[model samples]
Target: MGSVFHGDITVGYEDEGSGEALVLVHGHPFDRSMWHPQTEHFSRAGWRVIAPDLRGYGDSTAVPGTTPLAAFARDLAGLLDHLGIERCVLGGLSMGGQIVMECYRLFPERIRGLVFADTFASAETADGKAARYAMAERLLREGMDGYAHEVLAKMISPATIAARPDVAAHVLRMMTATPPEGAAAALRGRAERPDYTGLLSRVTVPALVVVGAEDAYTPVGDALDIHERVPDSRLTVIEQAAHMPNLEQPDTFNAALGAFLDALP
Candidate 1:
């Protein structure tokens, strides 16, 4: 674990291995630790893996006020600059995928490739926005205690919960540990993210889209839509997994990711 000061905020990150860089962003309510499997795997395969706790999630600074989703992207750009990386493949899961899209919008030149995992490319619908706002309010009012368990079924497959108690426990711990303010800020910010459908059509780099076969949040159809729009992209679906496939099925997720990284220019 290391720390870099991106302006006033101190972004906590884990940097490992060497060679080509691969920056993996964690999803909503989860910290950089969520990428432990990918970080170790890819780093061992001769890639520099950097995973950061987006401001509010991990040890990173929390937002005192509402923060735009783009702020997370800007923080990423700053982290790359801090590391003197000119360009690299950028990957994100769930909300992290949205952040990667924002990063591509703001610093296209800095992104050599893209990876979208269990995520979507559309803006939040009117109903979705309302739901997000409601969630934010609920988190603020009740915190993450029971709320983490409430969403665990949707985040991971039923098989995982029944067969892998350790994994289930880890996911719950990550979610429950998240600060309410940070989670709320992220929820509100995500509600306002721009539609990335048009942006996907313009992606020229080698792209990989991976989704759990049973992801309820984004769903397989959403991943297909993204794959259809992005010209140079391949899609992989990990069976028996849900939203967090990388955690639930690390070996399969890493296999798909490894092939993508190997084929990159």
Candidate 2:
């Protein structure tokens, strides 16, 4: 475990190996542990893997109010600064993917490549915004216990839940353990995120857009849309996996990710 202070927030992260940097960000309601497979694989393959628990998740400090995507992006940049990494191949899954895009928007010079997995670039629709706010309220009113149980299948596929009990348990554990206040705050802040569709077009670095064939959240169409918009990008759809392919099907996800990293300039 590694720690870096950003104001009152203490960012907790996993830093391993010793080579070119590969910084990964986990999704909402999940800690840095979600990237365990990637961290282990990439680090062994001669890359310094850095996976951080975003504000309010894992071992990091949780801010009570809304935490914007830009705040997450800034925290990532600050972490890199603390590590003395001038640039890196930034990758993220789900909400983390959006944060990675935000990083590119804020500091393109600091990014060498991008990996956007199971995420979209569209802004929140009015109905979606309302739903997020409602969910936030519900999270605060109740807690993560009920919500975690309800969303397990959606987070990963029903097939995965049944077939891979270990993966399912890990996913459920992460969601259940998340601080409701932090999750709710992220929900509120994510509600106001701007559209990144246009922003994808201006991406100067190599980009890899990946999705699970069974993904319920961000479908294959979303990945396709991102791939089309990004000037230098490739797309891969992993079969028999859902939103969390990195865990559901680690070998396939790692293979695709490894190939991308190998080809990066």
Candidate 3:
């Protein structure tokens, strides 16, 4: 684990292997450890993998209050600048995917390709915004343990929880261990996310849209929408997996990602 300071924030990251860069962002309520499988697999496949724990998660500095999506994007851009990487294949899952879209919005020239996994391209609905705000208040009031237990099944499928105890435990650990202040800040920021449908249509780089067939959060339909909107993109849906397919079915997810990376220019 290496870290780079961005003013008051210390971004904790993993930098491994060599060759073209592939920067993977972890989703909300989770840390960089969530991408351990991908880091090992892709780094061995001759790619430099950079996975970072967002400001409020993992070993990074925690800041109370809102952490806008653009803040996350700027942190990543700053990390790349520190590493002297001008470009990379940027990818993310869930809220991380939305952050990647914001990255593209701010720094298109720094991206060689795009990967959107188990995520959506729409803005938060009025109902979603309300729920997010409510959840933020709940996190601040009650802390993350209760929310982690409640959302564990939703984050991964029931089948996954039953069949893959290890993945289930890991996912639960990430959520429960997350700081309430940080998680609540992220929730507040996410509540105001803008629609990325128009932005997707303008993406010129080759793109990969992946989702779990059983993902209840984003669903396969969300991936399909992204694939259709992105002029040059590929879509892959992993079976027997849910929102966290990369952990629940790492082999299948890695195969799709590997193929996409190999095909990229």
Which of the two candidates, 1 or 2, achieves a greater lDDT against the reference?
A: 2
- Each candidate's clash count: 0, 0, 0
Instruction: Write one digit per residue (lDDT tens) for candidate 1, span 113-176.
Output: 9999999999999999999999999999999988898999999999999999998999999999
lDDT of 3 at 208: 92
Overall lDDT per candidate, in order of appearance: 0.93, 0.94, 0.94
- Please give, for residues 48-167, the per-residue lDDT of candidate 3 as tens digits: 999999999998988899999999999999999999999999999999999999999999999999999999999999999999999999999999999999889889989999988999
TM-score of 3: 0.99
| lDDT at position 213, candidate 3 | 92
Clashes of 3: 0
Which regions of candidate 2 are displaced past 4 Å? Answer: none
The true-versus-predicted C-alpha distance at residue 25 of model 3, in Å, is: 0.4
Query: Which residue pairs in candidate 2 have backbone atoms (N, alpha carbon, C) closer than 3 angstroms, thus clashing?
Result: none
